[model samples]
Target chain A: MTESTLETSGRDGLDEQAGGQRNSAAPPRSSRGHRFTSYDVEAFEVPGGREEDWRFTPMKRLRGLHDGSASATGSLRVEVDGSSAAKVETVGRDDERLGTGGAPADRVAAQSWNSFTEATVVTIPKETRAADPVTVTVHGPGRDSTAYGHLQVRAEPMSEATVVLDYRGSGVIGDNVEMIAEESARLSVITIHDFEGDATQVSSEHAHLGKDAVFRHFAVTLGGDLVRVNTKVTFADRGGDAEILGVYFTDGGQHQEHRLLMDHAQPNCRSNVTYKGALQGDSARSVWIGDVLIQAAAEGTDTFELNRNLVLTEGARADSVPNLEIETGEIAGAGHASAIGRFDDEQLFYLQARGIPYDQARRLVVRGFFGEILQKITIDEVRERLEAAIDEELAAVGV
Target chain B: MATLEIKDLHAEVETEEGSKEILTGVNLTVSSGETHAFMGPNGSGKSTLAYAIAGHPKYNVTSGSVLLDGEEVLEMSVDERARAGLFLAMQYPVEVPGVSMSNFLRSAATATRGEAPQIRHWVKEVKQAMGNLEIDESFSERSVNEGFSGGEKKRHEILQLDLLDPKFAILDETDSGLDVDALRVVSDGINRYRESGDKGVLLITHYTRILKHIKPDYVHVFVGGQVVESGGPELADELEESGYVRFANKKEATVQS
Candidate 1:
């Protein structure tokens, strides 16, 4: 199909389907106050075919997400490391941007929104120093067929903190997190996306960087049926730095896509991104798109982006596009690279000649492919957990 | 006892003209516990001979056979030959990312034993081997020669030879990039492994510095893709003192005649 034709068809089908449901009826509301936003819920619908952002997504997956009449299931219990885990309390819901899961249309259209209730909003006080990493384990039981989670983080000025967010559940978890860094603050966020069988997940993170502040985000995706994650960052002041790193392994009909948007709004700012993916098995697909925008006002901007992928099977596929849209010519340098390739036969032969069997040879390749990203995790315990989880995933994929 | 026998081996590498012969009518043998060094100048096909014996796909054997322990190995895949106790300390060891040195050695050792090595034994043995080579324990955790200096990479190859104890090991220009200390350490590893009476060694090099530490039982001069002279260790001394210029001139003379 022509690219344009596919876009139009996909958008048209999504608009009609999602739009109709949004305009239809408001289901009987619970006593809980769910603040309705400005736009009609349906108006917030993403045009499947016409939208460039939604092009590669399977529109069918978003069906019934906006239908209030859609059945809701019991909530799953939270457990961490096999013990009862603290759940993310939803005190209030941002009705519009609640995601396709019955989120009011206006909220979804806001582009960027943060709403919550009874949730623990972790705040690092100004000038506070946290040497030991803080661990947040999110527990969700697949009790409900659909669920929503919202988390907020704020790092005060001149403060330093490390947060590890672990996701463990057997249900579709739609989570939205918003973080803001105060001037001169440093924040490191490590997210581990791991869920059980029969689960679909979608998550979005939005962060605002302050002058001279530093923000680092690390994401590791190992298990999910159809997982999509989006991270958007905007540097509001100058002299700040941002680093984003991610690694994803897909196999056994799994599909994982990560989209990133980095806006360099001020001069003397720098941003970097490196994401690597390994795909195996039949029909497994992974996509990575990084869109970096340098605003006209931002002079002396420096940015570098790279995406590398390794295809482990003939049937599996990976696509990477590092897109840079710069508005000024005064920038120091703006560059991007996207590389996709297969296993190195010479490296494989070397490993095997060392006496590593075929299966172990495959593992060595994967470990090497993901080693750098894993090292970037920063948090030792979390890194170990991720390593164990990756091993489990590799075994499940029959690697 | 293990034995390596090469019988009338003929091989070639792909080129514009298609399969230019690199090794023609070459024959040699090294029995258990013997160290044989092959010397030659550039373009003399020294490395090509090493690769052909190791079953490198790039060098197709037009004819001839390689036998390890009296079993034909010319037909074996590279890995198959390795499993049959053939090891190549490459002239240029390929850099493998993400695969840690320790994990790689353990896996290789396991494959050699036809079963997984005991975890404790592996850890101890690998650490001891690395220590003997003056390699830090952390080296085992680092990716296999991913960003190692030339000397470090060569030492890493010897580390593997220590851990993956094959019946026969071929060191192809293994001493080229080593510093004085690294050369000694590498030679020490080879000498230590010589305790395994049945192990044979093929040392392919242009320089004789490595021979000062690990004496070879036999030395051969390769010219025009074939070994033109074979003698005792004194052959290495002859090449070291006078160099391969005469041999190169002789090959040119032969090619013209």
Candidate 2:
């Protein structure tokens, strides 16, 4: 509360920082190669942590995911459960649906594509509604080895379902996930990065929304040594709606980053993005990047993105950058907001003055900070479990 | 049954210009069943005294002693002071987002009462308290003081004063910004708490209008960060006619001479 937090940074002041490239069209001083994306690993060179997208990431901590040295010596275990209406298939690289959603944009993402052995595809049949949510759990190979994996969640036309992709346990890994929502389909993809031990992961998830399709994505990252996720979304036709919500807590010596891009390629489409994170203990760091591109053809696009971060301790830091690019002034609206606030001393003081102890006061403030997004999870089990996880984090720090 | 003492209290606040002394040396005593009105002009350190006693960090106690029942309150933390029966209904009640009023009241009640109030009885107690203050039942579901109007905030403060039932309540300008109807309701709440006979009350205000509704046993004319005169109810009547001009002029004259 002693300092003024940057609320929005706004579209006019995008070049002031490392991540503030307002328009990816000209991109201030970003590399021209940033716009190139491909399925081939050779398309992306080894990042030296200076590119606009890789600047915030610690390249050394990527643990060879950026290079081709991260060899897969150990096997990755995948578990699929729930949703009897959904069909699960382990398809080889030759499967036609393997790369239908989108391609890789970063070096690590391209490496994951070139290395993974098989892909898990969960498809909800056309015009069918799922009774239970599908849970896909991926456990990494421990320290002595690295694991590469792929997952694709496909929702057929007029179908409705929820998919939970959970990443847990040890080791280093790079992976790709694609979520394709067909015409008029309603799909929600929730990814939880709850890695244990010294796990390092680079995940890129591509989501494609067809005409009139509705897609909702959630990224809940809690435990990790170094976890970075890239979420790219594209709308193929009009009336498609997409929402991406992310919640993360970074502990001591931990780094968690979520990079988001929403591509409004079709007219009359809509998208909303929100992310909240809290960092505590020494050297705890977090990064949130929201890049929204509204093409000229998407004349009626309506979108807003917001990212908020709370730093709970002295050595903890949070970086929030929201970039908005609008090619057409005819669009309905395009807006982005970012805020990085330290533990509000006034908020803590207010609660403590009411006879609540210091620890309880801190917990209350943290809960309130994340309450708005957690309330939107819609899935009861996920919401409750995340609440417990937050409490456990507070207890770990003796808040 | 209880005594609240503030002896030779000096407090300062940090600002851009550096630490500025607010409360020069404040001495006052209020015992059970007694109401003392500390009347002063703006910037005379009236609210500063309230915050200093409540242990707000912004108001640093440079040199002072605040004792409740012979326990040094200055040595206690903010919440500890509340547990020791020293309550301050802040002039601007803070907005605690995501914390429901019911939850906050229960947590504070538990801390002060040394245990959780029985849920069944606690609901009834809170409902009755809110009803007595004319607050809507839905207020319990909302965040504490968030989006509350000026009148609503004051009423909520009195509601806490009633539910918490602290032995000594220091109300800092509780009557400010309240409409006529809200002032009546808030005064009634304070009056009910005072009628308990075992509680001590320190009412801080700039105007005498509130005195018409809730009479104080002692009225202290405050100026120059300390009380200049102490008298009975008739002193309020005198101030009502003369205002604080004479008291302020006397201080200016004393300072120059």
Best by lDDT: 2
Candidate 2 clashing pairs, residues 3+ apart or interchain? none
lDDT per residue for candidate 2 within A1-399, as digits (tens), equals 122234233342122222212222223353221245677777667888987789888888988889788888876899999999999999898898887787887688889988989999999999999988999999989875799999999999999999998888889989999999999999999999999949998999989999999999999999889999999898888999999999999998899989888988799999999999989888788888888877667889999999888888778878887877666677888888888877877777767776888888888888988987899888899999999999999989984
TM-score for predicted model 2 compared with the true structure = 0.93
DockQ of each: 0.47, 0.69
Cα distance off (Å), candidate 1, residue A3: 18
Quote the positional error of residue B21 for candidate 1 in Å.
8.7
TM-score: which candidate is best? 2
**Candidate 1 lDDT, A298-379, residue by residue in tens:** 7888888888888777678776766666666788888788877786777877877776666667777877788877887776
Candidate 1 Cα deviation (angstroms), residue A239? 4.5
lDDT against true structure, model 2: 0.86
